[model samples]
Target: MVLAAEESQNEEPGPAAPVTMFGPDFPFPYDDWLRHPAGLGTIPSRWHGTEVAVVGGGIAGMVAAYELLRLGLRPVLYEAEEIGGRMRSVPFAEHPDVLAEMGAMRFPLAATTLFHYIDTVGLRTRHFPNPLDPHTSSTVIDLEGERYRARTPDELPNVFAEVADAWDKTLQEGAALSTMTQAIAHRDVPTIKSIWNQLVPRLDDQSFYGFLAASPAFTSFRHREIFGQIGFGTGGWDTDFPNSVLEILRIVYTEADADQRLIVGGSNQLPRGIWSHEPADSAHWPAGTSLAGLHGGRPRGAVTELRRTPEGIAVTDADGTRRTYPCVVFTGQHRLLLSTVRCDQSLLPRPHWTALERTHYMSSSKLFVLTDRPFWLDTDPETGEQVMGMTLTDRLPRGVYVFDDGPDRPGLMCLSYTWNDDSQKIAALDPEERLEVLLSALEDIYPSVDIRSHVIAGPVVTTWENEPRFMGAFRANLPGHYRYQRRLFTHFMQRDLPAEQRGLFLAGDDISWTGGFAEGAVTTALNAVWGVVRHLGGACHPDNPGPGDRYDELAPLELPEG
Candidate 1:
C-alpha cells in the first residue's frame, strides 16, 4: 500500500521500494512534451481521420485522448461513471464554495507531470495542511490514551523525535535512499539503475515490516510500534507493513508524501478544465476544438467488450455499437478490463494477463464535513490553544485535516481518511453511521469543543474499496511481485509484445512503477501514446524523444532472479 500502517511484525522482504513515491523515468522532458513545438510527435496525415477508442474518462484516459486529438487522431472516449475518475471533487449543496475532495486531495511538487496538467488547466493550488506543516497551526498526536499538541518537532516527546531520526537513518543506511533520490533529481538514469540493481536483489523479496525490523534504528519494538502508529508524512504506515518494500521506497524516494498541496477550489477542476481547453495547435480538428466538443459535450457510454478484428481492434460500448479502431488505449483499472469488460484473451499475452491478476489494490475511505466556520481555529479560553488542527491518531478516525477557509466562511474538514482494514471496516457502515463514529472519536480527543454543534452541512463519505467502477483506491504490489510489476510497467513499450497484442495498450497508475499517484498515471498515459503512435506507423519528432524512444536508457532496474 502506498499509504497505510500496521503493527510491526516478523515480515520478510518482498519486491518493494523503501517507503517513497517513485518519480518518472522517461527521457522526454514533461514541460517540453506538454508544449513539444511539434505536439506529441506529428502522426502521419493519413492517420488524422482515423478513429481511436480511448476507454475510461479518468485523468489517464482524458490526458491520452487530449494528446491523441492534438496528434490528429479522432479519439472517442468512454466512461463507466463520471469524468475525472478518482480525482473527484464535490461541493456541498448548501455551501457551493466549500468542496470535499472525495478522491485525490493532495499532490506533491515532485509530480511534475501532474503539475504540468494542473498548470495547463490554470488550476490554482495552496499548501495542504499536512501534519506539522507550517500551514497547520497545530497538530495533535493521540495514541494509547495519551494526547500531545505539537507545533514543532521539539515540542513532541523524545520518542517522536527518535522515530523521525530512526526513519532518516534507516532510509540512508539501509535503502540508500539519499543516493537514489539524488540520481532521480538529476535525471541520472544510469546512476539510479546501478544503485537500484544492487538493492533490488537484496530487498526485492523483503516486506516493509522486515525493513523496519532489520534496521538498527528501530531496534526496540516500542519504537517500531510508534513509527507504525504515527508515521512520518502521510500518517501511520503500519497498514503498508505487509506490502513490498519496493512500493514504500518508491514513495519515499520521490517525496510523494512531502511538500504536498491541494487545488484551490477542487482537483476536479484540472480534468474538467483540460476537457474544455483548446490546444494551441491540433490535427484534423481545428486548433480551438475541445474534447467536450469532439464528443458533443458528453462522453460515450462505458465499454462492455474488447476484441480483435482482422483489421484492428473492436470495441463495443454499452449500447452495443461496435467500432473498430487501429489502436486502443485502455486507461482504467486493469481488474475492470478483465472482470467488468469482456476482453478477448488473445488481446494480451499470458505474462501480461498474470500481472493484471496479481496487481493488488489498497482500499481507502474518506469522510468530509463542512462546518459553519473555522471553529477549529478558535482558541480555547482556558489554555489559549487552538481547538483542533491536523490530527494523527491510532483511534477509529486515524487522520483528520482541518480546512480553514476563512474567519467567517464555512470551513471543511476531512473527518476521516483511512486505509486497508480501517477503510474496509468503515465501508460496511452507512454515511450517517460513519459520521457518528467519526464524531465520537474526535470528541474523545477534543472533549471541550462541541464539534457537532458547528456542523451546518452533511458529512459526505466515500468508500472506494467496494465501488464497482473502481474496486480499490490505488494499486499496490504484494511481496514477491517485482517480476509482475516489471512486466506491467514495461507493457507500454509494445515492441516487446507479440503482434496480436501490439494495438491494445494498457495505461494507468496501476501499470506504473509508482501507483496511487497522478504522476504515474500521466506518465503511463504518455507512454501508451508513444506506443499507439508507433503502432499507427507514426514517428516521434527527432528532437522531442518519447518514452519508447529512450526506453533503453530510462528502463527501470531489473529485479535479479532468485
Candidate 2:
C-alpha cells in the first residue's frame, strides 16, 4: 500500500527551521472567519499572475486551491494521497455490495464556507433541516440501571434549570473562565483553577449523578439497554472505543451550536473537488497557475515522506522537474508541518516535534459492509427519506446506512464505525476476533433479524485511523489543549516571513474556533490563501485570480437529474 510519491527518496535531508502557532492573530479575525465576511465578494481580486501552491488535498486545501482560482489567484495543489483525506467516499469492489461512506456522512447548512462551494459546484443535497430537534429525536443518559430515552420538552427540561449557576459561570461573573471552551471542558476540575473553579467546589459536595437524574432536565429520559445499541450510526458515540453517557446524549440530543455542522450528500465532495493536486507546469498555464495531480502515493516505513516539496504557497505540488515558485500553502497535518515542510519552526515553538507529539486528537475507524439485499431500515414512503435506521430489535452489523431505491443494489446498505483510537492494533487483530466484533455489534442492534445469517459481505476497513497519509482525523483539541489554542489558532500560520518565504499557511481544522469544524476547514483555507495574497501584495481575490469561469461539468448530481 506504499504510494509512489513516498517510495523513493532522491534527495538528502537538511532541516531549514521550526514553525509554531504561539501568538499574533493574522489572516481573518477568529470571530469573522466563522461566518462569511459581511462584505465578502466585495474585494474580488483581478489578477492573473498571482499564483499559490497548497499542500494536502483535503477539503481545506482543495477549497483554497479552487477559491484561489475563483478569487482570480492561481494555485497549485499537492497531496500525499488520493484527493479525499479523512472525509472520503468508499464503495465495495463487487457489484452486489452497496456504496458506503467511511468518513463524514452529514453536512449542515450553517457551515458557511462549505455552503459557498456547494452552491458554486451546484452539487445536489438534502438538508438535515435542524441538527437538533424534539421530533424523531431521543437521547438517553444511563448511569448503570437509571436510564431513559430523552423525549418531549419534559424529558430533558433544559439543563439551565439546575445548572443556572454553571450557565452563569459561562458568561463572565459566576464560574466562567477566560474562554468558554476552557470553562466547560474543566467541569471535572475544581471550577477554581480554570473558570469553573467555583463550580468544582460546589460539585464536590453533591452527587452529580443524582442531581442530573432528579433535575428537570432529565424527567422524560426513558432508559434502553445500551450494550447492543452502540456503533449503529456508522460512528455511534464511541470515540476511541470508549464512550460515556454524556457523549451518547450529545449525539442523540445533538445541538449544532455556532460550532457544529454537517453535509447532505457527504463531506468529502467539498474538500477533494476544491483543490488542484497535480504538479505545477508553466507550459500549460494561461497566465495563471498550473498543477499536476498526485498520480500515485503510499506509506513506506515509519516516517511518511512525500517525493514533494513543502506544500508550496505559489504552486500546488512543487515538481522538482518543473519551475519553482516562492510560496506554498500546507493543509496536511500538524506532524507534516514539522516533518514535511522545511521552514522555521521557532515561529510557534513548543518542543522538538513535541507539540506535534504531545498533541492528543480524537480519532476512530469504521467498516462499511454493503449487502446484496436491503437490510431493513425505517423509511418515509411518500418522500423516501430514511427514518429510524435500526429497529428496536434490529441487528445491524457495524455501521449504519439508508437504502437506495434501484435494484442494482436496491438491497444495498452501508455501515461504518468511528471515534475510536485503537487503529494501530487493527493491523494486528486476529481475523476471527474482528468478525466477532462486527457480528456481535449487529446482533445487539438488531437481535430479532439474525442479520449475520441473512446477509453476505466483507469490504470492511477505513484507514482514517491507520494510514500515515493523514496525521489523524482532523485534530480535535484535547480537554486542556484549548488553553494554548489562542496562540494555536490566531498566531503562527500567519507570520511575518519575507515575500519569498510566505510559503507557510495552515489549511486544516486544527485551530479554528467557530472556524474549527468542517465549515471551519472551508473558510480557514480561504483566509490563509487570501492572507497570503494580501501579504505578498499580489493581486489575489475573487475578482482577479482569473476570468470568472463556472464549472459546467459535475458527477451529474442534481435534484432535477435525480
Candidate 3:
C-alpha cells in the first residue's frame, strides 16, 4: 500500500528507529548511513561539464538528477505531467486545506534511503494508521457480516493469532526469514546471497498462493483464506496471490511494509523538495542552484522520441525541441517507452526490451472525499464505540482510512483503495458513481454513522492503471519473471551493458529488487546516479562505495539458466 499523509502541527519523529524484523542480528544501519555526509562519490575535474538527461520527474528521476548535480554534471529532467509523477498530492477542490493522495501515500520507516532525503528537506511526518501498528488507535476488520475492532492483537480473534503464528512458522522453517533478514540488516552481503540464492530457484516459479497453500503450518484451507482476507501488514493478499512469491518475500524479509509513517503535508514533498533544493555543495552549479531553477522553473515537456546519435543520445520532447546528453537515465515507466514514445530499437538490448515488455504492473484505484469532520468518531448508542478507525473488509471497498487534521480542521477520508481486478471493475465509472458505490459499502459496514451527511465535497478518484503517464501504480512481478526482473534491476551497471547502450540506464521502483516501495525507487535512482557518473568517466569515492562497487557482493542471486 502507498503511504498517506495529513497536516501535522508538530515535527516528524526523529530518524526511524531500528526494527527487529530480522531478530537481533539484523545488520543494515540505515540511520547511520543516512547521517553520513560524504555521499556516493565525486567525479574527476575532466568530467565537470557533462550533461545527463533524467527522463522522469518522479522520486527516482528527481533523486537521480539531484545526485548528478552534486557530482558536477548538469542533469536536464523531462516530464510529461506534473513533477511528482506517482507521488501526487491532490488538494480538495472545495477545501484546499484537505488533501487526497492519488498515489504512493504511505511510507515504511524501514526505507532508510527515502528518509535520508526527507530528513535532508526537513519534511514533517506523522504515524500512519497501518493495521496493528501501535499508532493506529483502532482497526475494524469486517468479513462476512462480522465486524471485529481491534486496538491490540490480543483483542483479535484466536484465529487471527493462529494465522500470524502460522505465517511466521512457515517463513522461518521454509525460507530462513530470520537468517536472511539478519544478514540483510548487517549488510552481510555474502551471507544474504547464500541464503537468498537457495530460496530463489526454489521459489522463483512459485506463486504467493502456492507458498501459503503448501506450507504445512497452514494445514487448513480456512486458515489460508482468513490470512489472505486480513493480511498481516496491509489488508488482503488475494490480489497479490497470483504474483511471485519472491515479491512477497522481499516485502516481508526486508520489513518494507512494517512500522510505517506519512509525510505531514504529503509524500510528494520529498520529490518536489529535492527538485527545488539547492545542494550545499555541487560540482558545476553554485550551492544556491536548484534543478527547477536550472530548467527554467519546470522540466522540459514529455519526451516523444529517444534514439542514439553519433555524439550521444538524443531526446525529442513533446514541444519538438531536441537535445543530446552524454548520459540518459530512463526513469519513466518501461511501457511508456515501448508504447507511448518512439524508442530506437537499438537503445536497449533485445533481452532488456523483452523484460520491459513482459514487466507486470498491478492496477490500483483510490477514492477520497473531504468531510466536514471526523464523523466516524461519533459513538454508537448500543456499543458506545466509534463506528471505525481504519477498516479492512472483503467487501467492495477493501481498505478504508480516516484522516484527522486536528479537531476543527476538515477531515479527509479515503473511502476505498482497491487493487487489480477490483480496481478494474470501477475503472470506467464516473467519480460520483465511484464515491456513491464506496459510500454504500461504508454505509453497510457502519449503518449508524451518517457518513454522507459529513461529506463536504465531491470525491476525488484515481484509477492509476488507466493513467496515461503511469500505466499502473507499481510493479508486481509475476511467477517465472525473476530473470526478466534481474535484467531490468541490474541494467544500471555499466560493465554489463554493451557500448551503444552504456549511456542509457534504467532507474525506477520497477527496476529495483524490491518494488512497490519508495526505498526501492531511491535505491535504483542512486544506482542510476552511479551509472551516470561512471558513463561520464566519473568514479565512485573510495570511502563511499557506489552500487557498482558492491554489486557483486550485494547483487541478487543468479538463477540457473534454462
C-alpha lDDT of residue 45 in model 2: 39
> Using alpha carbons, what is the TM-score of model 1?
0.94
State the displacement of the C-alpha of residue 241, model 2, in Å, after optimal TM-score superposition.
Answer: 12
Candidate number with greatest lDDT: 1
- TM-score for every candidate vs. truth? 0.94, 0.60, 0.94
Q: Which residues of candidate 1, in runs, are more than 4 Å off?
A: 1-32, 560-562
Better of 1 and 2 by TM-score: 1
Ranking by lDDT: 1, 3, 2
Q: Compared with the true structure, what per-residue lDDT tens digits does model 1 show for residues 1-562?
A: 1111132131433344332233433334555566667667877888886889999988899999988988888889999888889899988999887889988889998788888889888888999988888677999999998998988778999999999999999888887776677556655555566666666667778999999999888898999999998898867999899999888988887789888999998888887887888987786887689899888998999999999889889999999999999999999988997799999999988888988998899999999989988989888889888878889999989999888867978889899999999898789999999999999999999888899999988888888878898999999988888888888878878886778888998998999878888888888898888888898889888878777887787676666555
Instruction: Give residue 511's lDDT in candidate 3 (0 to 100).
Output: 87
Candidate 2 lDDT, 354-446, residue by residue in tens: 545545555556565555555454344653533234222223233344444444444434443434434444434543455566667654443
- What lDDT would each prediction earn against the true structure? 0.84, 0.41, 0.81
Give the better candidate number (2 or 3) by TM-score.
3
RMSD of 1: 6.0
Runs off by more than 4 Å, candidate 2? 1-47, 96-98, 127-266, 272-323, 340-357, 378-388, 391-416, 421-427, 430-433, 453-456, 492-501, 514-516, 538-562
Kindly give the stretch of ten consecutive residues in candidate 2 with the minimal lDDT sum.
547-556
* Residue 164 of model 2, lDDT score: 33
